[model samples]
Structures are given as C-alpha cells and as structure tokens.
Target: MSDFYIRLYKDSDYKVARQLFNSGNAKHTKKAFKHAMRQPHIWPPLLALLILPALDIVSFTTSIFAVVGAIVFLWFAAWRMYWSYVRLCFLDDMLDIRRYYLEQDGRCFWVAESGGQVVGTIAASPSSYPGGENHVELKRLSVSPSHRGKGIAKALCRTMIDFARHRGCKAVVLTTSLVQKDARKMYDKMGFRLTHNFYRPKPFTKLLDFKILFYQYDIPKLQ
Candidate 1:
C-alpha cells in the first residue's frame, strides 16, 4: 500500500474493475448466496432439492424418461439460479458501469493503483432515497486479497469518507454482509456506527440467517 496511488476511475479502469468484480462473484457466489438461500431471490437449485421430493405426487418417477426429465429440469433450474444470482444480482452494477456508477450527478469512483496496476477500488455517490439526497453511499470497496493488511483498505475507507465530506454530504452510508467480518471491524474502527440491521426473507421461512448490516458516518455540523 505504501507505493499505491489513489486516482479517479478512468475508462480504462473498467476492464480491470469488471474482471475483479466477476472474479469476486465467481469465487464467492456459491457461499454467499448459499447463506441467503431462504431469501426469495436466490439459489433455485437448493429450492428444487427441497421441493423435488414433493414431485412424487406428480409421478415424476413413473418411468425412466420421467425421472430423466425431472433430473434435467432440476439441473437447468440450478444453472439458471446460479446465473441469476451471480450475474444479475452480484454484478448488476458492473454490467452497466458507466450508466450506474459514472453517469450520475454527484457520483464518483476511485481506484488504487500500484506500479500502474489497479488493485483496490471504491465508489461514492449521492443516495437516491427520500431524505438521503444529502447522504452518500460508499460502495464496491474491494481490495485484492493479496494486498490485504497494508493499510489499503483503511486508506480507501478514509478516502470515501473524505470524498463524501468534500461533496457536501451530511453523512455517508454503506451496507455489508455478515460474512464481511474483517470489513465490519475496520468500519467500526473508522467510526462508522451501525445504523440498520435487517434480514431479507427472500422466499419466506425457508432460508434464514441472511443478515445485512448498514453503517453510517455522520458528518459534524459546521461551526
């Protein structure tokens, strides 16, 4: 982190960001989505696994072909669910970076580069919800696993807070999953207070324990 430089995101940074985003989801999609499977919006395969036993009522096992058909259908549903979770949910913003992250007013993205190579990233923009116009959202903070513990994450977090302040934001907010333990600790140390804790019932009582936490950094009033 010592040699790294922080700068505004450029058009060229898109490729690296996209790659990083995809690699991140490709690696953790299963575990993260698996944790939230009870959420109505993710992982259709496990749902099938639970529901398939009921298909005995439909006589799916009546013939070898029926069984094969059921098997193929389950496989296809699983594939679709994986695709939806990873591409549509995880990488949705990166799918249209310019439109989502770059084109908005009061929006900005930054990258941490070392040796001319991008290794860390963060973004901040004004919130869209009512009463949040004065608030900023710090998002997409990613540091290469290899670059951990060198103060890069701290620098990026500080960068976003400062950016928000400079942008005249009253506060900056961010959300993270319970899985991001290290990040949660860092945010606590950085003076971000927990503002919300909620669970999404994606599909009802089936999947549980999908905890998401929101943190807020309130800017002090001017003298």
Candidate 2:
C-alpha cells in the first residue's frame, strides 16, 4: 500500500483547499438556507398583508401600520440571520484556508501527496490559558471527499494530538456541532469525551442551529 504523508500546511496549498471548501459548500448551502427560512419567526407574511392596504380592504391606517411592521420585522430578522450565516461561512474559510497561508497563529498542518497535491488538512492553535499550560484547539479538519473512509481524519487527529503533547499541552479541546455525527463518533473513538454543550450564537456560527459540543482529552504523559 502507498503510504499517505502528513505535514505542516504551506502557502502553496491554499488553492486546493479553497476548491475543496467551495465544492463542499455548494452541496449544503441550499439546504441550509431552506432550514433557516423555516424558523418560526423568520418568514413572516408580508406580501399578503401588503395587498390589504392597496385594495383598501381594511382601515388604511391600520393596514399601513401592519404592512410596515411586517416589513421592518422581516428586514431586521433577515439581516440578523443572513449576516450570521455569512460570518459563520467566513470563519470556516478563514480557519481552513486563509489562516494556513497567513500563518495567523503559526499552527496548522496539511496532508498531501509527496509530489505536493493537497488532500487533507488540520489546523490548531494554543489555548487562551496561563501558567505554561496550553490547550490546543483543533480549528479545522477536512479531507477530500474522494479520500474519505481511509482513516485520513483519524491520522490527522492523531498527528494533532501528538503535536499538542510535544508542545507541552496539558489537554486538548475541540468543538463540533451535534449534527456532524460522523465527526462526533470519530472524536469519541479517539478517547475525547464530551465536556459541555452550549449555544453558540455568534455571527460567525449562525447556521449551527443546535448547541455545540465541547470535547476534551487529557494528554498522556510520555514514558
């Protein structure tokens, strides 16, 4: 069997990473939009109400107020929701692609062909803790769809764990949405246990309708 190699991400890998991200995004964006529109307070009835005023079928003043109210509500709601979705998408792209080339925190890795074709990637950064005890956070991990079912994610995760250990981290932590069942299963199999579940409503994570699961695993002492 040909061995797959993993290494640090390089500036040259950005193009392939972007291509992979766009392809994956195209597969899910429409469904995500539909899901967002179905939220109880999102798609309020506006056009049907607008006709009430034009036909003078009701008190004009009351109809005007109702129409204006609905328009304002929809505008504000859609503004909040769409921007949130955009931020979340940008956050993923930043962590997955841009940060690698920019070396934002100087911590990221890539898996690729020896001849230099990028196939998978994993990125991490030091945690925001003091006392020389760092918590490594896996920011992103992705494999080409064609490369799935070959243990790439597992190998990438193991590499990250080893890297964190080498850097003297006391523990490693990561968060994934409950919707990502396969990823949750993989993390569980890797000995990471769920530590918390909480809502993340930041503009950069709008599409994550459910609470996020935080997982943690203590680094074993080296013999």
Candidate 3:
C-alpha cells in the first residue's frame, strides 16, 4: 500500500488502463458462466439428455454429445452476453475518457500507480439519471489481479469519494454484478449500502438469475 499512489489519469495511462479493464471484465464473464452452470434449471436439460440414453431413446454416444454441446452453448452465450456489454462501454464513455470524464466539469478519472505502472483505475461523473442532479456515478474501477488485496482498490475508491465530496455531490453510487463477489464485499466494507438489484431484461440473464446490484454512499452535507 505504501508503494502505490493514486493520481489523476493521464493520456499515457490509457493503454495499461484498458488492459486492466478488459482483464477485470473477463473475470466477470468466467464467473458468470460458472454461476450459470450452477443453476438448478440448467441441470434438468442435461439430465434429460442422460435420461434419453437410459430409456433407449438415443444412443449413449449421442446423449453424451448433446450434453456436452449444451454446456458449450451455455458458455458461449454467457461470454457473448458479457462481452456485448463491454462493447457498449467501449462505444460510450470509454471510447473517449478524456472527453467524457477529464474534459467535463465535476467529473474525473484516476489511476493507481506503483513501480511506474498503472495498477488500478476509477472514475466518477455526475449522475445520468433523471433526478440524480446531486449524485455522482462511480465507474470503470479496476485493479490489477496481481496487485489486489493490497488496498489499491479501496484507495482508488477513497479518491473518487473525496472528489465527489469536494464537488458537493450528495452521494457516490456504483453498480456491480452478482459475479463480482470481491467487489461487492469491498463496497460493503467501505460503508456503501446495497439499495436494490435487477436482472438484465434478457432471456439468458433471467434464466441464470444473473443480477446487477446498486450501491450508494451518501455524503453528509456541509453545514
């Protein structure tokens, strides 16, 4: 922790920061695929394939192929779902971090540097919701896998929170998914409260019970 420092993001940090973003998001896709496989509903279809062989409806070899194919399809579906979201992110604010965050008033991006490498990143912008005029949205937070557990993420988060405070924002808000267990725990420890959650309005997400969680940390207004 002593070796790392948090500072405003720079153009030079873009490449490494994008790598961290992709790596972090890739982990979520893997976790989501695993979670999808664990759902009770997923087993019934595979079980049916096995039962076909027992009932002599299909050869054992064909049943095996069907089960394996189903599993592969599920994996592919999960990957597609997650990466599609990532692509949209790339098309949006991430497409031009400077224009979206750095160039805008009351919004900024920060990175954690250690050994002259960017190990973590976080950004905050005025909330985009209809009635969130005083709120701030925390975005693009990622820490290098190798540098995690050393307080880099928490420190980056603190930087964003303090920035929002000084900017007179009412609260800091962030959204994380069910697969991001570590992030959920960290947010809880940092005094952010879980407000609500919802599953993406898609068949695959609904089937797997994949959910997105929203957390908020309200700042006390200055007297």
Best lDDT goes to which candidate? 3
1 against 2, candidate with superior TM-score: 1
Q: How well does candidate 3 score on lDDT at residue 84?
A: 84
Q: Write the residue-wise lDDT of candidate 2 on 94-199 in tens digits.
A: 5456454346663655555434577777767776434325788875577778777778789888888888888877888887755567788999999999987876
Q: Taking the tens digit of each residue's C-alpha lDDT, what string does model 3 give over 57-165? A: 9999999999999988888878887788788888898888888899999889999999989999999988885567789999999999889989999999999999999
Query: Cα miss at 21, model 2 (Å)?
Result: 3.9
TM-scores for all candidates: the values are 0.70, 0.64, 0.95
lDDT of each: 0.70, 0.66, 0.89
Judging by TM-score, tell me the better candidate of 1 and 3.
Answer: 3
Runs in model 1 lying further than 4 Å from the true structure: 25-86, 89-92, 204-208
lDDT of 1 at 198: 78
Which residue ranges in model 2 land beyond 4 Å of their true spot? Answer: 22-106, 114-116, 129-133, 202-209
Once model 2 is optimally superposed onto the true structure by TM-score, how far is the C-alpha of residue 165 displaced, in angstroms? 0.7
What is the lDDT, from 0 to 100, of the residue 89 in candidate 3? 86
The predicted structure with the larger lDDT, 2 or 3, is 3
